[model samples]
Target: MCRLTRLVACLLTLLFLVSCSSHSTQREAQPGLFLSSNNLPVFMSSPQVSFVLITKIQVPVQEGFDQEARLRNTLAVLTEMAAEVGANAIIVTNAEEFAAAYNRVSTGTHFLAGASFDLSPDAFKHVQLKAQAIYLNR
Candidate 1:
């Protein structure tokens, strides 16, 4: 009899916690910005004749719980940037040291439910990526 009472109490507590999750109270994750532009401005690290126009760049993006999805989006942006410059090589100068946070949002439909979500920071997180890359003209 005591065990049953304890179980009931635990279940009720769990339900209460889930229901009390107000939107304002929920922790928001920082969002990654990708593909802001294809042809990012390039600055040469050295002064050389017809220097390979590469930029020391930083992409301050990627935040959320969905790591795989965020990584995919980030990679796509970098690829487009590379292609735009007709570059054949990229080297990392620096990488960010944090994982962006995100949450799952769900919507319901008649006899079914659907949902989609993205990285959006409720509380802003400062993140940056830096790279010194050399792009060989293709």
Candidate 2:
């Protein structure tokens, strides 16, 4: 009876791990909001389309992780933010990378204008991407 109980526990643990792994893997590949400069000319030329506002969006840096994964997550955040504002599309105007350096080690830090945070000198590295969030009149 003890052996059987142990086996059941082990199987449940395995199942839990497998489920968590599969869920994370599926999320990493999903696409976010529309990103492009191709439609700039078309959107600009049309009188119907109007510019909303220019803003900067930052995605938190993943700690000691894969660059591709970090970028994917960041793009997801940007997409969500744009969607919240009812933006038609996002135009990346510029980007800047920020880091906190301590003992010759650099880590990313996230910051935005008119926002404040309290953190130790050494935090992390953050990529601040400047984008123009636009919404069409019609």
Candidate 3:
């Protein structure tokens, strides 16, 4: 009980510190309110085609990471991302080694981890890439 409490407190402190010292980036909090006019190729509506979610959340190895837990988190993030993009099915998605080099000092061990995802359609017609929920290209 005490250990759990300490861990929670530690996490809260870490979060507070991070929030206070986070690098700022400009993005509208609510996305998908309206069509974006970035002049990029994008589909307007959800399609019957499948999708794949790709995420590359890499971290330094100072904090120990369980491979199983990392995989689960990555999968969850992917699922949520896919769902947001009007996609229900995913294919050809996987994580690969980005880089891992660490030094084990007298204090602790450090390492690195990286992941990725790639999405593509099974087939398409007259469309570029036919991905990201491309429809009617069977």
Candidate 4:
């Protein structure tokens, strides 16, 4: 019985380790499509190549990600969204930063059988991206 218990414990530990592992997948840009911030591409403005606006998109900023990573993630998300709706290009219109409020929770072990919990309101930096998804006709 003791041997069986040890085997089960080992298996459970392995399972827990596997569950804790994380894998992140990044989206690849579609061919002939591009994402740009602010200015529209010069080629897009040419009379030879006309474009039509598909829809406007807004991506909420993700907390805990660095600025470069956030921009990459945002572009990936915008590209995916644009491709889903058959748009071939994305032009970022604006980026706005503001403070967001949330609740922060803290917990501690109080005596032997008791626990303590504290909750407070906190503010955090937040950003939002606005863009237009467009399809080009060349």
Q: Specify the highest-TM-score model's number.
A: 4
Q: Rank the candidate models, highest TM-score first.
A: 4, 2, 1, 3
- Best-to-worst order by lDDT is 4, 2, 1, 3
Model 1, runs deviating above 4 Å: 1-53, 62-65, 96-125, 136-138
Question: What TM-score, computed on C-alpha atoms, does each candidate reach?
Answer: 0.36, 0.38, 0.27, 0.44
User: Model 3, range 21-112, lDDT digits (tens) per residue?
Assistant: 31222221222322222322333344455433322122222222543443444344433443344333333211222122121221123322
Deviation in angstroms for 42 in model 1?
18
Whole-model lDDT values for every prediction: 0.40, 0.44, 0.31, 0.50
Each prediction's total of clashing residue pairs, residues at least 3 apart in sequence or on different chains, is: 5, 7, 1, 0
Deviation (Å) of 116 in candidate 4:
20
Model 4 lDDT tens row, 1-138: 999999999999999998653322223423344444333332212235576777767665444444456566666776676666566766676643312211111122222223234421121212455566677776
| Candidate 3 segments exceeding 4 Å error | 1-65, 92-94, 98-138
Worst 10 residues of 4 by lDDT: 98-107
What's model 3's TM-score?
A: 0.27
> Which consecutive 10 residues in model 3 have the weakest lDDT in total?
122-131
- TM-score-best of 1 and 2: 2
> How far is each candidate from the true structure, as Cα RMSD in Å?
16.6, 11.8, 15.8, 11.2
